[model samples]
Target chain A: AQSVTQPDARVTVSEGASLQLRCKYSYSATPYLFWYVQYPRQGLQLLLKYYSGDPVVQGVNSFEAEFSKSNSSFHLQKASVHWSDSAVYFCALSMTNSAGNKLTFGIGTRVLVRP
Target chain B: AQTIHQWPVAEIKAVGSPLSLGCTIKGKSSPNLYWYWQATGGTLQQLFYSITVGQVESVVQLNLSASRPKDDQFILSTEKLLLSHSGFYLCAWAGDSGNTLYFGEGSRLIVV
Candidate 1:
């Protein structure tokens, strides 16, 4: 079974500060990695995804994630985060061979940007 | 542009009451539909998926059932709601088996 782990349960940062959210996955095959953001009372929206090629994938709102095969990590990074960036971030992984193509997601990390 | 919509944006029903949530996808045809449940701060758990109308697969059963009556409509319902069902329910549509899922705004349920 594929699983995802997000170490940080909560992260606090000041506005304009750089941010990094750690994510690790365990899968038998090369999994499809994704980063999703959920605002308060809203469903999650995709931030970025990596299928093949290009270790770094850029997403909406200047979000980017780097996929490392050896480390089994796909960490989301932002050069400068704004106050509006405060939300819950989830890292998900999907295996191609799985039934229903279900996505295993991390517990999520709540980001709070202090203005 | 494709859009997904879920009905009853927020609901507060007494425990043991019946429940039903609906999702509709527009600007797309014959898309794969899915139902997912999320606890207060937990990861999402897929409940069901439908490849076509009238055919649904249960990924994980939580005493709930899902039906895809139309090519673009999915419904999640239960005869009796439980206190454990108090959380968020999201509807998603995937282009393929399960690639990128476009999610609806979601429906929040509170079984008090």
Candidate 2:
């Protein structure tokens, strides 16, 4: 079974400061990775996804993620965060062979941007 | 553009009461539909998925059942609601690539 682990449960960063959320996955083979953001009482929105080549993938709102096959990790990064960036970010994994492309998500990291 | 909508926005019901939730997808046909459950401040767990109408597969047993009677509709229901079932229910559709999933606004349930 594929599982995602987000080490940080909560993160507090000052506005305009950089932020990084760590994510690690456990899978026998490389799986499709994704980053999603959820605001309060709202559904998740895809931030970005990693498929094949290019270790670094860019996403919306100046967000980016680096896929490291050797480390089994895909970490999300933002050089400067706005107060609106505060939300719960989830790291998800989807196996190519899984039925329906079921996604296994991390517990999510709640980000609070201090204004 | 494709859009997914989940009904009733939010609901509150007593324990052991019957419950039903509906989802509709517009502008897309024969799209894969999925039902996901999320506990308060927890990760999402896939409950059921349907590749086409009249065929539904259960990924986990949460005392719940899902069905797809129409090509663009998916339903989730249970005979008796449990307090543990109180959470956010999300309806999603897989993109053509089958790699990305687009989620609806979600339905929130509170079982007292």
TM-score of chain B of each: 0.96, 0.98
Native-to-model Cα distance after best TM-score fit, residue B101 in candidate 2, in Å = 0.8
Cα error of candidate 1 at position A90, Å: 0.4
lDDT of each: 0.92, 0.96
Error of 1 at A75 (Å): 0.2
Against the true structure, whose lDDT is highest? 2
Candidate 2 residue runs with Cα over 4 Å from true position: none
Interface RMSD of each: 1.0, 0.5
Off by over 4 Å in 1: none
- The CAPRI class of candidate 1 is medium
lDDT of 2 by residue, B14-93 (tens): 99999999999999989999999999999999999999999999999999999999999999999999999999999999
